[model samples]
Target: MRPVRVRTVAAAVAGLALLSGCGSAGGLESTGEAPSAVGPARLWPDLPPASAAPYDYGEGETARIPGITVPGDDVHRLDPVTVAQAGLKARTKRDSGLDELPDATVRQIRDCRTAPGDCPVLTPYYFDLTGDGRDELVIGVRLPERQLAVRAYRADEGVLTRIMSTVDAVISVELAGRDLVLRAPSVISGYEYRTAWSWDDRQQAMLATRDEILRVPERRGERTAPTPTAPAPEGSRPAPSETPTA
Candidate 1:
């Protein structure tokens, strides 16, 4: 898929501001001066292995776990752990299952897509399965005629394998005790309200629609006055004063 071209100027500016503060005395001098003593260089902390052994989900046709709905276009199985190992950050819309896939597999998937020209180069939506601190990859696709495909993957056997029923734009994904729900409007005109779905078992799948009424939160009190700005730091340059012309 091709990359999306949205510019995140605000985010870039915020990052620059943070970097600018790093060299400032106030930022680096947070800790008081230490006693004059020489110390040996500290050893780097021992860290866990970068990658885990590829997970294995027994070879066979992917079975449909009860309450899960698999999408037709999802071509492969993926292991979630492998996705994380490949340097894809977790829990954001752009974390595609690409890292989980073999290079050839990813290229093939990209080429096979209809209107691959319009597909996003980066995957959007970071999905966490099991919620044991690792995140799975999610890929979304828009077909030519208003159809949407959402696929999830976990790493297995050095390859990404798809989880059962982990596909669809509108799906009810399970989250620990709390059900991660998805709602979509029905195609029929009379059914204007959206239909809801939830995951059934620990595995991913969209279950039957369930009606749940939620109370909207009430508005809070009126707005308060803006706070005053802090004065510039001591020894910092002040704003330039205007000079009168003769």
Candidate 2:
């Protein structure tokens, strides 16, 4: 019994010694001083808030095509050309003070009925932009001044609703996941504007969620006129391979 007690005491001492040796090992070492934290500073707090809302580039605006109906709840089954035609006619009749489509663009739409080869409507893309199980239809109509009318439509119970509508001097249009991203050349020599429209379920429309100007180093050598202007032709426009006409 005495021998057993001694062995227990020796084992406890050995465990304590091992723990003490581990405690002598190095701990966290300081690298350097971290930069001071700077938080956003609000400026002009005393100024009165603006009375009117900020200008909306047609975001959160949705309208149903009057004459056009989706045969089924499937947007993929609808003809894109017919949808564009109906939308054009409806816009022409609307009293909204928005700029009217140019006569040349109207003619192109009309001519597409007989000559699809020369249609200005780009090949339609189907994407589940709303996160719904079904796909929505996205189409682009080439306009004058290199502007492209990018529209998104969703169909439910035979009713076709235009969920989004925006015209831009597009350098490129991309579908990043469910978001629609548009890149446009900025008046700033070395920068470009990128806007992203995202689905808003509450509004039942697509909203411009992000708009930023990014430095485009590759275009630094290209000199665009500093004055406010429209987008250039093919040079700065979305390439045909990327947005080929249907």
Candidate 3:
């Protein structure tokens, strides 16, 4: 016990002695080496890893940010993302996203199809998916969870209304003639799920005529009948010799 006490005191004293010469209270500390004892060498390092961009605040050199934008009116326009989000929320009956969006991200939906100027809405495809001569708007909306929503809209009397919407993950949508072909990735390695949608007059909507998980079997060839080899040429063929040929 006595030796242990002495050893503990000695260790404490040694630690204090070692730290005594470290530095004084005035020793300023910072990330970069002190420029002159008060501050760092430079507040920020040269930007752009390779080379610094020339910052000349001339007439147009200064960046001018436009005014605030928000989701606005839409008569014949639909953003794929916003529509997809709405579709997801409608289908799940739950908030698809949190309300914690940055002020910079808050945007008004603007009708980009008719209202000139540059709009944030993505371009939509037009096809008569409803069997009317007038083309209907078809859009593939990208959502979270790698989900996608294929929606079709029709504009009648200055009103754009969504008529059909289907959402799924890992999906690919295509227009085959008048039919809409939708394919989703299947768990099975070499197969996928496919659904062909065609507009039905009586149903007044797009209905899937074919829906099935199909295997796109790989094209492999097996030799059912081995290729025959040509017999040795008569002239090149060696004659059957009774004895060893000279």
RMSD of each: 22.7, 18.9, 24.0
- The residue ranges of model 2 lying beyond 4 angstroms of the native Cα positions read 1-37, 54-56, 91-100, 217-246
Q: Taking the tens digit of each residue's C-alpha lDDT, what string does model 3 give over 135-206?
A: 776775445466665666555554444555566674678889888898998999778999887776664556
lDDT on C-alpha atoms for all candidate structures? 0.40, 0.82, 0.55
Please provide TM-scores, in order, for all candidate models, with all chains considered together.
Answer: 0.31, 0.70, 0.42
- What does candidate 2 score on TM? 0.70
Error (Å) of candidate 2 at residue 231 is: 42
How many clashing residue pairs appear in each of the predictions shown?
16, 0, 8
Candidate 2 per-residue C-alpha lDDT over 1-246 given as tens digits, one digit per residue, 9 for 90 to 100: 999999999999887776665533633344589999999998999999898666634557777877877776788888888888877755422334343466788788888989887788999999999998889999999988999989899888888888888888999999998999999999987789999999999988888899999998765666655888766976777655866577
Would you list the clashing residue pairs of candidate 2?
none
The digit string of per-residue lDDT tens for model 1 on 1-246 reads 223323466667777678667855734334577789988875665756547436432211122222222243222333222332332222322234322434443443455456555433334445454343445455544433333434445433233444422223342333333233544335553232323333334434334335543433334664456999998888796766698556
At residue 234, what lDDT does model 3 achieve? Answer: 84
- lDDT score at residue 157, model 1, on the 0-100 scale: 28
